[model samples]
Target: MHYRVAVTGLGIVNPFDGEGEPNSGGVTDFFQRITNGQSAVSLYETQDIPRPISVPAVRCAAFRPELRLGKALSTMMERFAQLGVAAAFDAWQDAGLDKEYCQASGMTEASGVAWGTALGGLMAFERGYRDFWQHGRERVPPMSVVLGMNNAAAGHISIQLGLGNSALTYSVACASAATAIGEAFQHIRNGRAKLMVAGGSDATLAYAVVRAWEALKVLSPGDKATAPQACRPFHPERAGLVLGEGAAALVLEDWDHAVARNARIYAEIAGYGANADHMHLVRPDQNGQVAAMNMALNEAGLSPSELGYVNAHGTATREGDPIEIAALRTVFGRHAEQLAVSATKSAHGHLMGATGAVEALLTVLALHYDTLPPTAHLDRVDASCAGVAHVRGTALRGSKVTSALSNSFAFGGSNAVLAFKAVR
Candidate 1:
């Protein structure tokens, strides 16, 4: 029998702060900021590049993993792993499975960790390379290799949580986290595990990462001197994406298991679909995107008209946004006009591999609360991307949302789409 998956808890570490600002700390604060159209994109300075260019980025400047994680472990972890561990801790606590309590109950072995990241421990990797090549250091830190691996975050989560089931990592570019969460949901659905910590993390603000993006010429222009609304998705004057760093984790449990435990169910993981385009390295294909969405809707037993909202992968790039709109229109037909399409990246900046996990959590929260976050900075819709119900200006509240989808179209032609439904 095919089992169902339930989202029991969520935790996040984004550029958002609870200091009456746009930074999202947790689920509630994140929803509030997005609904308020607050932009977290700001000018950040880094020595990763030669001249230290000022680029628009979203960073968790306030996150002190030491306060949450112990000093020793915190120091050993790189920024991405730290964010992942912090989010995992919050998720574990939120799910009412305290670390000590879980160990006491002997449930650690039944749990697993599945995470994703595009560039793992990027900051440390850059530093280590610099030290070895430029500074000619005799020896690097012992933990440098451990921290530089793409599976480092997953390994850390498994160790910290004492999970022995399995620890898996996906590196499918931007769709990484969504793929992880989807696979974790399948693990629970197949009765392989009763619970899992699933998410994605990336801290790619290093000089090499930024310089690579700059070379692609897909990054938006403007520094500290410009306004926060630099990356405007679907706007007529849209520039490009602003990369950010963050982590998000969701606690997925079996439906019957969660219900038996009397746990709070935020939403149900109804369906998941992923496919690849063997076409281009960077440019997205409408056919591939449509296939992904259709597969998800089909698996969820949902029609295009039944899909209330879509957390679009609107990276604000001219080539990407219009193609996404075309795919939606083709799949949803006339229903596309009634759909609440919102590109939240306009406010939070693109979190690379971690983006899908963040958006998936937000989508589940949206379905639970019946509130759709707006696409910030959508001043004038581009003529090519029009004809859809783009939620702008304010959050669409009190809408009867039965199901929603989060779309992640990454580089390397990977497309992952996850479907969520209200826990009715």
Candidate 2:
């Protein structure tokens, strides 16, 4: 017996209200700011390195985990785990799954957590390196191993939520979160679990991580004045991606379980498709992208024309944007021209492993409210990326979006696509 997955709640800890502000208003406020074209990207500078470095980045500067998770719990986890636990708590509360209720209903053994993080505990490791190499220390902290592990977030979340079923983590670069969510959906759909907390978080603003990305020449260059417009997806003068630090999570429950509990359903996860390019280690393959998308549509029992919107994995890189558009053209054919597509990364910046979860949340909200967020800073669409109906400048409201796809294509040839249908 196949089960259906329902997204009952959402949470985020991003720079959605622009830089330096806490996301106090939660997901609704995030949707409002992003759809209004408010960018969180800003000029980031740090003198921690030998030489001063400046670049555009989105940082959740005001995210205080202590205030949300308490001081004792906050101090035990690294930045990524802190962000992940806070977001998970928010999602749990949003789903109406409090500790008392979970204990009363005997949900401990049926619930689980699946999280993603590309650079897990990067900040802690960086700090350890600074202490050892820069300060000439003999050894690092003993707890560094537990705090710096990739599965730390999932482990903490499972413990906090009393989830005894599973605690899985994925580190698939940019598609990590989407893969986690997709796998969790599969687990629930196959009757392996009844409830799952699925999402990702990354806090990789460390000096070394920034320098490594800088070495790739893909970090968008900008000054204070141009920082807000640095990431222009599908634009003629699009530079490249802006790195970000954030977390996002969703509570996915079995459809029947959600209904029985009177939980509010935002959208139904129709299908998830995951595949590999097997063509390049860095460069994306259009054929692979097309196949991944087709697999999702097939699993969802949806025609190409039925997909009303697409949350594109647009990194604003010259080669990547055009190839993604080409794949969409091939998959949707003439209907590609009618598909409402936008890359919300333009406003929130790219959160690496956490980006897929952020974009997935935005896609769910778009379908829930029938409003499509726009690609900020897109003054003129690039000639090669002009085939689709781009949502730009401001949010497109009342489009009656019924079904949508969230695309997350990562390096190393990993591609994951999720299909969502609005609950009528």
Candidate 3:
């Protein structure tokens, strides 16, 4: 027999707030924060990097600057790792019974960490090169390689929280974090383990990475002084998405297990569907995306019409925004209009691997809060595009959506969809 997964606790470290934000911020809070002038995007300041361009990036949740990061943490990994650890513990404590909730959730002291990332510790890698060319390998830090490994975020969280079950990292292009959340949900639902700290973390606003992204010709080429409509998800002017970083963690618990302890239940993770297009490296395929959504709905024991909102993958890229619309048309058909559709990238920019997890949490919060967050900066909807309203300007209120979907499509044609429902 199969079981369901519930989000009992949430810990988010996004650009909108500090790492310790209560998981209680549902759609309204999230939308309000995004619209209220909170931003993670900024013009980077670094030496030798003149006129350093701005990118949608963040360094959220961490041991405060006073905490003193160790040499073990390359500069890149310091705050980034701290963010994961802090957020993980915050969620652990939030899920009722602190260390006591451990056993109730079926988590052994050996509980694992499911972490995701688009690219891990890019700055650490740069440090190694700077030392290699400038100083020499002899002067390079001994722990540089370890710090830059994709698993750094997970390892740090496991060590800080002392969760020992199994700790690993997923690096699936952009879908990495969403995949991590889904896999962790599967682990708890299948009785593989008790509690899992799953989400994504990344800090890629360095000189080297930004310049390379500039070469992609997908980023905004216009003005940096003005925010160039920070991430225009579905609007025609969307040249490409602004890459951002951060980590969002969710605590998954067994149904009967959580109820016995009188724990707070936010929503149920009824279904998760993941697939790859194999058609192209970066280009998304309609059939694959559509299939993934259908699979998630089927697993959720729901029909297309049941989904009230779709947290779109809407990266705002020319090909991406439209392709996702086509896929939605195939899956939701005429009901697509009724489904409140919004792209969070419009507000916080593209968080990459952590994007899906962050957006998933927002959607789950929406179910609990009975409101839909606005997809800002979406002033005009492409006339011929699928009419999901493209949610723009301001937030919407009063919709009790029992079920919803958050779509994440990553590079390498990776696609993932998560189905969530409000706790009854």
Candidate 4:
């Protein structure tokens, strides 16, 4: 028998405040700021680079993980894992699954963790390299290996939450987090686990990482004045994507189990579809995107007309934005003209592996509140992206959004789409 998967809780460690201050309001504040069309992207400069390159990007400037995870626990992990653990803890608490409550209820063994990150522990490794190459040090940090591993986030979350079922990690470029969430949903739906923490975290703001992206010529250019408006998806003059670093998590529980515990249901994770282009390593294919959307809609038993909104994977890249819009047009046909579409990356910047989780969380909130967050900084929609009903300038409130989809198309041609429905 297949069980239903429900999203009971949500958490995020994002640059929601945009003022170099800590965001204490968790997911509630995240939703409000996103809908209000705020931009967290800012001009960031590399300290270690000799030339000191500056670019428009989003960084968790105020994320002091030591405060959230405690000094001892935080010291053992790198920034990626630290962000993941903090987000997971918040989601666990939001789900009402405290350690005492879980132990008393015997819910530990049936729980698991699935996380994603494309450049896990890159910061830690960079520090070690700087010490050895720049400072001429012979020894690196003792915990470097453990802290720099890709699975560190999942392992820490699993241990902290007393989850024994499984602790898995995915590193599928930008699609990593969406894949993690999709697989976690499948695990619960297939009766393998009753509850799962699914999310992704990425911290690739290291000098080397930023330099590599600069080599690709896909990063948006900005100084202090233009940084906040650098990522304008669907806009005619949109330059390119802005890199970001953060984490977001969702608590996926079996429907019956959550109902039994009287957990607050945020939304139902109705379907997930994952596939690859198999054509190009970097370029996105319209066929692959359309196929993924069709698969998700089929699994959800939903038609094109039933999906009220689409959180597009609009990276603001010229080629990428047009292809994604074309795919949506093909999949939705005539309904494409009416379906509300927006890309939150316009506000929060692209979080690499963590982008999907953050956007998915926003989509869930959109369904729950019946409000559609706009694509920030979209002054003029490109003609190629004109078929869809773009949400711009400000949020659309009280629209009765019953179902929605979140799309994640990554650099390696991997595509993942998640379908959700309001619990009401």
**Residues forming the 10-long window of minimal summed lDDT in candidate 3:** 60-69
Q: So what's the TM-score on candidate 3?
A: 0.89
Question: lDDT tens string, model 1, 308-359?
Answer: 9999999999899999999999999999999999999998889998999999
Give the winner by lDDT: 3 or 4: 4
Model 2 TM: 0.98
- lDDT, candidate 2, at 384: 95
Give per-residue lDDT, candidate 3, residue 15: 59
Q: What's model 2's lDDT at 389? A: 95
Tens-digit lDDT track for model 2 on 231-278?
Answer: 999999998999999999999999999999999999999899999999
Off by over 4 Å in 4: 17-23
RMSD score of candidate 4 (Å): 1.2
190-219 per-residue lDDT for model 3 (tens digits): 877666788887776666777887788777
TM-score of each: 0.96, 0.98, 0.89, 0.98
Which pairs clash inside model 1?
A: 16-23, 16-24, 17-23, 48-207
Give lDDT: candidate 1, residue 60.
85
Question: Stretches of candidate 3 above 4 Å error?
Answer: 18-31, 35-40, 45-51, 54-77, 97-106, 135-137, 222-225
Kindly give the number of clashing pairs for every candidate: 4, 0, 4, 0
Model 2 misplaced stretches (Cα beyond 4 Å): 17-23
